[model samples]
Target: MKTLPAQLTPFVRSDVTGALLAETLGRPEEEFSLAELGRRIGAGGGVVHKEVGRLLESGVLVDRQSGRNRLVRANQGHPLYSLMRELIQATYGPVPVLRDLLGGLDGVERAYIYGSWAARRHGEPGEYPNDVDVLVVGDPPRRELADLAVRAGEQVGLDVNITRVGRDEWDAASPSPFIATVRSRPLVEVLTEASDG
Candidate 1:
């Protein structure tokens, strides 16, 4: 998880907004319903609704009714569309990308980014991290997880290292040394069940 250029951080307000922009406007070719967009970005409907409204008013997003649903998409014609997309990519792309890539995998319960990237995200000053370390709590196959990591890494332009653990191992009353160590560090959760328990 490399720190996005310091200059760009100020321009991007919330991660939720950035994620929405990156997924919709950044892709430009895709359209998403409001509920779908909220789920994809790991944001509640109200938050997504508010941000979408703001972007819509700014002419950065366009929404059209399709049957029973309203599909929202990037306003590719907007003059600042390209610049905004680039900024979202550099600042808030990874978390949503990772969430979309790994969230619904069979058996995946939760995913967290733990390491230098998490540290930087938590506001500790440092150079861009060279890699992203991910902790996956579930029983998904190694090959499957590896393939996902590769794809996610390609999307974010970072090396993604995944560590997996079974539910019992992850939720034990007394955590193992490895789990304890991970828990002690700064962690940016990527995907989690609706109920954290």
Candidate 2:
């Protein structure tokens, strides 16, 4: 076994992280030896070896090996992967329908899943969302916002109620009563914020 590097914090590259994650998601949770993972991603064998070593050291993966072949999985109990899975399941599920609806909205910043769906997915809520509550920020025309919500609702089979607020509203100590209503829902998403503008 190679001795682990003493100082690899700043050296850990995001591109490598992305490549690993992409490769993991590309397959259906099939375990791969380090070398096999490297081949799949077009990375050199040594590089894959090092990356796998780092991931194993971080407790982000668990593995069993036969000879040189190793099988690895994202640690189910690992906090990061758990959270990532939850967010991915929620966002990629019904959220895309809503995201498509916001396509033409100018000044739209970003969308956040903040309410019941998020709460439930993140384990903040005891129950899952029955409907979707979304917060829209930006300068989208009112009609466009309404239309988006309607389309999202129809497509995703959820009651997609969208609340529009400006970036300034979020910065205030307290948002308006209207925003408060959306926030109070079992599930809510702050679909846009100032930084997204």
Candidate 3:
């Protein structure tokens, strides 16, 4: 198992989050069963079901039931989804531009393209992503990363936001049923490699 850094000890465990997302990605058409979701995340089926219910209430996810089974899906049409895209596209898009430029010190580990892009890429294509919402793990230099993002915004119209938080922070927040649901799905559409030094 890969270990998150000490500073990121405050974030939620990406394992469960990633597992749930991977399962969702695998099943493009089927609504995930509580048992299936639990099996994927290595937790009790009941626990997964409860979490899914919580997600539904948070407006981060939506679900429909078929008999005893419940199908859950991310609510991409939500306003925040558009807001996230705008922020990213308005910030970064150019290939050789400043904001389009990623520096070495940005503490970006693995990045996942979640939200609208992911929904469109996996399910049905809707509006093109305005900005890209990337879930960045690891702590890169904040100022440099912000500078690059700002420059990219100025050059290209891509609103690219580097949502880089520590693992510990993630862990701390996930305990909340609301946050856990919000993060129930993927973060962006394209999982790109950070720029080379």
Candidate 4:
């Protein structure tokens, strides 16, 4: 999301645009209101509205008004639909992909993408991350977590590293250098137990 339109891939106009396509194009069957899109991406509603407007005008997305809400979904008939989906999956796929991969798991109190990938996603100017770093807080089975990491990495076409920490060790009160370093950087929340409920 931090990559400017020019710095971002040629297809995307902005961070919001990338996120919008990732949500709509990545899940073509689902429709999302502007507010929901903003919330999911941790972006402002105005930014999401603007991006949706651009996409609608360009026929990348189609929307219908439902009361006061604007419900939008991907336009499968658009000629570039396939290309857009592919680009979005590679660039903006982490959030939604990780969300899906972690949603059903038990003992996952919180999960996030950290390190350089997160820095880029959070708007910091940095080299494109060579791999994705994930921080999982809780005691999920290591085997299950590792398996899901492989699946996620395949979908995004990048190496995904999962680092596990117990809830108590991840706490700020604890004297863990790893937790402190992660806390000090840009982090993207993938999923949380509260988000599920």
Candidate 5:
């Protein structure tokens, strides 16, 4: 089977590591309590506790006690911080970032990433993808989504393309040629109503 990006190998080897990297490294400026981190990553409290201890010992993360809770954050001062940040962004940033950016928009039912980046993630050999192509299935306000896409593109260092479609159009038995093409391509689903459930 095709594997995750090589740079993410270490983190993906375990769910805990992957969640920690995705939740903490992706936002180095933010600190998370164990409970909050566990909730965000869908991990059990015990697993997060053990993994956080290991990470703290390895200097990949730093923690400080606040009253009864321990708050943890990525160790920005660590020598490998920058490289880890870049790899985290390359491997796990796009989907979550786009999900957060677009998931709350009114009428958005689902979102997917298609084209080059999706192919690359599926282990297709090629040059690195430089842009993110997002397909939004819903009737969200076009201007607002476009504006959010611009901001997200800047944050992720990629040109973001947002394509909107209505629910009826997306569920049609006979889709348009453009929709057919998208359906035939490799897709990385970022958000869906079912996912939340």
Candidate 6:
């Protein structure tokens, strides 16, 4: 793994660390195995293992060996657990929160975060995004989506705007200039066929 510069002291640490913490702390009651964390975070097992070690040492996470598998979960008893959870959730919560929300809606075939936030996530150096822009492809109810966006925004501590479009309108062959422009830039997938439906 590449080392971060000595002067940098990000509260969330590496992307792998932030993502792993989000998954565990998002659902504090749920326990996850190391391999499962790696799979869920789309990171290498060794990378996940190293982050887990750091968390364990810091008392931010707790672990136990369940027969052959080692399981880890949030250490809710830690002094800084609540504070850290809030910070991590607000920063790294979009993907998991959006995925969980969109997963409940039957008509949401796909969902993505585009614009500035996506650009930054894609490694473009720039200012932090002021709002999160989401594009949903399918027929999910607009009113429900609006309400969901509000809830997601509250959790993320950033404004979340949703733009819903039918599957046809979102297709590459479609003539929508908006879709065309979005396709030309970075898009972070929030929901897709690969994840659980």
Candidate 3 residue 144 Cα shift, in angstroms, is: 1.8
- Against the reference, the lDDT scores of all candidates come to 0.78, 0.56, 0.48, 0.84, 0.78, 0.83
* lDDT tens digits by residue: candidate 5, 8-121: 334354535665776799888999999988766556888888888988998999999999999999999999999877776655577768877887677789988998887765
For each candidate in turn, the TM-score is: 0.74, 0.45, 0.38, 0.90, 0.72, 0.88
**Greater-lDDT candidate between 3 and 5:** 5
lDDT (Cα, tens digit) per residue for candidate 2, span 1-197: 11222111123243344345444532326677776666544567777777778888988677887776788866676767755443333333344345445645786776555566655433342554667777666667778778877777665456777666777885566878866765565442333343233
- Give the least accurate 10-residue stretch of model 3, judged by summed lDDT: 1-10
lDDT (Cα, tens digit) per residue for candidate 3, span 41-77: 4556665665566656767467787897777865666
Candidate 6: misplaced stretches above 4 Å? 1-9
Error of 1 at 65 (Å): 3.9
lDDT agreement of model 3 with the native: 0.48
- Model 5 TM-score? 0.72
Among these predicted structures, which one has the highest TM-score? 4
lDDT (Cα, 0-100) at 134 in candidate 2: 73
Q: Against the hidden true structure, what lDDT does model 5 obtain?
A: 0.78
Stretch of 10 with least lDDT, candidate 6: 1-10
Stretch of 10 with least lDDT, candidate 5:
1-10
Clashes of 6: 0
